[model samples]
Target: MLAIRTKNLGKEFWRQKKASGLLGSVRSLYQQDKERVVAVRSLDLEIAAGESVAFIGPNGAGKSTTIKMLTGILHPSYGEAQVLGLTPWQERQRLAFHIGTVFGQKSQLWYHLPPADSFFLLGRIYELDQRTFEQRQAELVERFELKEFFHVPVRKLSLGQRMRAELAAALLHAPQVLFLDEPTIGLDVVARQSMRNLIKEINSLGITVFLTSHDTGDIENLCRRVIMIDNGNLVIDQSINSLKRDHLAAKIIRVRLEHPVEGLPPIDGAQVLKHKGAGLKISLDTKKLSVDELYMRLRQLAPIADITIGDPPLEDIIANIYRHNQGGGEGHELEQEVAQI
Candidate 1:
């Protein structure tokens, strides 16, 4: 079943026109000139139940606007959308029971109260029974390791601890879908990894996960599929593997040799990026030379002590995609609006 779907969904905003000179400013005030800005334009998307998808884009690319529309926080200017079979704007109250949202920059928990208090309030809002709420609360508190600080005031807990409590509270009512916006932003390395693991666990339990993050690690580790937008237009929609393979069309090979290498052998698509006495870093274009063929040639160089071949960093791949789209004018139709997502 489709957990989320949209067809030609779009949003627009109007800004009052400003005049530079005194007379023009006075005329503008009297006339009230305004210009229409399209934040999202003709977006069509679908996400399946139990799927983990990353919705990514550059700043002001309408990622936040699209998510807001989906969550019923904002109504679209045109077109239609459904979240878990309910029109989000039409059935927002009902949909609230089945969906949870987490924004890294925003706090859903009360600053002065302990997380336990917030959890109970959420349970009441979701209409969960007393027994059920307590059982779920215990499970979340245990799973999130909140015993040490569960009763601590939210303002006093560390960012990592507070985020953990936040996730636990969001899951207290067992939502069917979760919308996560930069859930690991500002977290330490360990805290980020912990958050990613917890999100993966949530997805494994069959809740649809729609994630938006600037951190490439989140996209690489958490999402199977990626849907990217730019300037409010759909730019790319494909699986993560396909996105890397098709867009970048290259790989990085690190080889540690048994002996020092004076120079690399002639290979059509292979470029030696770095070479030390016994280590080599090579970038290979898969379109011109196959990985197996490159491996065979590398083996011919010397008896290899060790080798590791992997894709280029996801940041590079995403940058490449963005450059291609921008140079090709793929998403220039929608006026770039200043937005925070």
Candidate 2:
């Protein structure tokens, strides 16, 4: 089942034309010109139930706007979004009962009160029975490792601890769908891993996750699929691995030859990115040349001391995608060979 789906989902913001100087500003107030900017263009996406999907793009690429429309925080200018069979904007109040949201940049917990109090308040707001609330709270606390700071005042807890509490609070009602926006933005490695595990556990419980993040680590580690958008347009909707395979098949060959090679080997279709002290890093354009051919050419040069071959960084892949799609899905379609699982 598709827990969330959209068709032609879009939103536009109206901005009054800013005047140049003091006189222009004063004149503009009397005769203001407003232009409509499309924050999200026509988009079509569907996320299956229990799927962990990452919504990633550069700043102002409509990640937040998309989430806002899906969560019913903002109404779309055109098109529609249905989450869990309910139209988000039309059935917003009713939809609240089935979804939870966690925004790391924003905290919902009271500053002076401890997390326990916030949880209790949420329980009452959700009308959860006392027994059920206790059970759910206990489970979330244990799973998120909140035993020590569950009672600490939110303002007093570390950022990581507070984020965990926020997650626990968001999941207290066990909503079937979760909307997480930069949930691990401020967390360290340990806390980030904990959040990842929590997200996985939530999805394992059949809760569909819609995550928007700038951090590609979360996407690579937790999400099997990724949706990329730019200039408010849906650029790509594909599996994370498929994206890597199809757009990033090049084997980054790093070699430490026995002799201090004067310069990078002139291998066809390969570009040397770095070279120092008998070490060389070359990015082989796998589509144009095979690894076997490159290796054969290297054998004539000198004995190789050590070599390492690996996939390119996810950040690099995303940057390339952004650069390649600078014209918004219209130019420089660099397709990579699909990698075998």
Candidate 3:
């Protein structure tokens, strides 16, 4: 079953245009001008049940706008969408029962109340029966490891602890789909990993996860498919592995030598990014030169103490996509097609 589906979904906002100076501003009071800004344009998307998908884009690229539309926080200016077989805008109250949302910058938990109290409150809001709510609450509390601070006031809990509680509360009603937006924004490394594990477990249990995050770790570790948007248009929709295979033709090689060398030997398709005495960093184009060939050349230059080769980071690959499309050429053909719609 499809967990979410959309066709030509789009959103637009109008803002009052302000004049430059005081005189101009005063004149604009009588003659107000508004400009329409397209936030999301002709977005066609679909997600299968139990699939973990990453929806990522730069700031002001309509990522949040699209989420709001999916969750029924905002009605689309045009097009249609159905989440879990219900029209989000028309059947919002009904759809709320089957979906969960977590916005990192927003808080659904009561600020002054304990998480335990908030959990009960959310259960009531979701209209879960007392026995069922209690049973689910107990399961979530244990699964999320909230025994230590479940009773602590939300204001008193650590960011990580609160995030755990937040997620637990979202799942109180056993939602079929989870919408997470930057869920690990302010968390430390340990906290972030814990949250990631919990989310993975939830998805494993058959909940569809639709996520938007700037953290590459979240995308690389949690999602199998990636949907990249730029300038309010869908740019790429492909599996994570395919994205890497297509755009990641370059490798970074770092070698530590046994002794300092005056000059390094040059190898075809390899450019020295940094060189300082016993340490050298090179950018290798794997298409032109194989790792074995590069290793052979390095061995001829000097005795090697250690060497490590790795692909460019996912951040670099996504940034390249954005930059490539920003140039207004063949790379932006997809976006142009949406604009035409």
Which pairs of residues clash in candidate 3, taking residues 3 or more apart in a chain or in different chains?
A: none
In model 2, the runs with Cα more than 4 Å from the true position are 329-341
Count of clashing residue pairs in every prediction: 0, 1, 0
Tens digits of per-residue lDDT for model 2, 1-341? 99999999988887667569999889877777666667888889999999999999888788999998998989999997899999998898889988999998999899999999999999998889989999999988888889998888999999889988998899988888999999999799998998888888888888888898889998998899999988788888999989999988687999888888676547778888898878888898889888778776776777888888889989899998887677544432222232222
**Reference-based lDDT, each prediction:** 0.90, 0.86, 0.91
Model 1 lDDT tens row, 51-112: 99999988888899999999898999999999999999999999999999999999899999
lDDT of 3 by residue, 17-112 (tens): 766999878978787766667788899999999999999988888899998899888999999999999999898999999999998989999999
Highest TM-score: give the candidate number.
Answer: 2
lDDT of 1 at 194: 95
RMSD (CA, angstroms), candidate 3? 3.3
Superposed by TM-score, candidate 2 places the C-alpha of residue 133 at a distance from the truth, in angstroms, of: 1.0
Model 3 worst lDDT run, 10 consecutive residues:
332-341
Candidate scoring better on lDDT of 2 and 3: 3
